[model samples]
Target: MPEKSYPMTAEGKEKLEAELKNLKVVKRPEVIERIKVARSYGDLSENSEYDAAKDEQSHLEDRINVVEEMLKYAQVVDATSIDPDEVAVGKTVTYTEVGETDSETYTIVGSDESDPLNGKISNDSPIAQAILGKKKGQKVTIATPGGKFDAIIDKVED
Candidate 1:
């Protein structure tokens, strides 16, 4: 099978690595121990604790596998290389809505690193696609859940 590629920032990769380590080193062992104890307690079919522990072990292993795959195909993105004058992944951009006059700020990141609540948006997102390669003072139309609206790029920063 082809290994999937992951486009992620260094910080994001580190976070994922930490989670993987936790799952493998801590959670996996803890769940196995729980299952062993539960097995000693009672009959297999009627033991809810054993069932729950087994489920937890499955989930933990699944997470470990996912993280390993992501690590294998990880692509690190550096925030410093992006041009301050252009919209690109790893760039922090500020914009103002055309008619609403409200200003918004967001950091363009890879799909794996996007966290909307923290103002980090995926480069593949509609808004990012509309703004990519655009410069300050350039207007762009974005189709959002709220509705289609226009925005003007105010500034681009690291």
Candidate 2:
């Protein structure tokens, strides 16, 4: 089976790289020092500090591995390469729901970079999936976990 690809913007990939670097160069060493300090407390079985440090290290290593894998399979999508009026990953899309006067704008990004509160949505999300590859002024029906809604694409920008 083929490995799953992590589609993201170049900026997102850079962010991941930076995170990976920090994890390896800073966090990893810090965790090691913590473990060393905890070890000095003696009694590994009952040492709360050692247990906490080990747990933190485990979580950190897991994050490092996940970030590494994402970097390894990253497929950077250049918004400039896509049509200016078309919605796609790395592009900001503005849309208005049918019968609603308010317009919401969101940048479509990869799952790793999704932050709904900041207006960055995952391309895999129902709204993004419905609008992706669609041109401005297009009407699309998005089927989200909550329900389905009709929306009109108002704009697409890099």
Candidate 3:
């Protein structure tokens, strides 16, 4: 199967790249050093230090592979190009739900950058999908675990 591309902001991409570099250059070397020191303790079977180091090394390698794969298929979505009326990645959308008097705000972003508590939501999410391509004053309804609720487009911003 082909690798799936990830929608990411430039800053989000930089953060991932930084983590990859740290794992490859800094963490990798540090783990190697630890392994070396642990090996000096004698037989590997009874050495808890050696076993722990080996487990850490395995985890580091797995992280490196995951990061590399993410970078390999990254589809950078620039926040600046997003339209004010369209629900695109990196844009903040304002809406009012049915049966609720107050309005709410949420930023449409990549899945990696999404933090519901922080008001950032993945563009591929059901809520975002419900609002995409909609303009101000348009109503959208989406199915959620809480049941279907209607939302009216109030505003969009980047």
Q: Which candidate's lDDT is highest?
A: 2
Instruction: Name model 3 segments beyond 4 Å from true.
Output: 1-3
The digit string of per-residue lDDT tens for model 3 on 20-73 reads: 999998999999999999999999989999999999999999989988998889
Candidate 1 residue-wise lDDT, 15-40, digit = tens: 89899888888888899899999999
Clashes of each: 0, 0, 0
Single out the weakest 10-residue window by summed lDDT for candidate 1. 75-84
lDDT for every model?
0.87, 0.95, 0.86
Q: Using Cα atoms with residue i matched to residue i, what is each candidate's TM-score against the true structure?
A: 0.87, 0.96, 0.88
Model 2 / residue 93 / CA error / Å: 0.5
Ranking by TM-score: 2, 3, 1
Report the lDDT tens digits of candidate 2 across residue range 108-155.
999999999999999999888889999999999989999999999998
Alpha carbon lDDT at 34, candidate 2: 97
How many Å off is the CA of 61 in candidate 1? 1.5
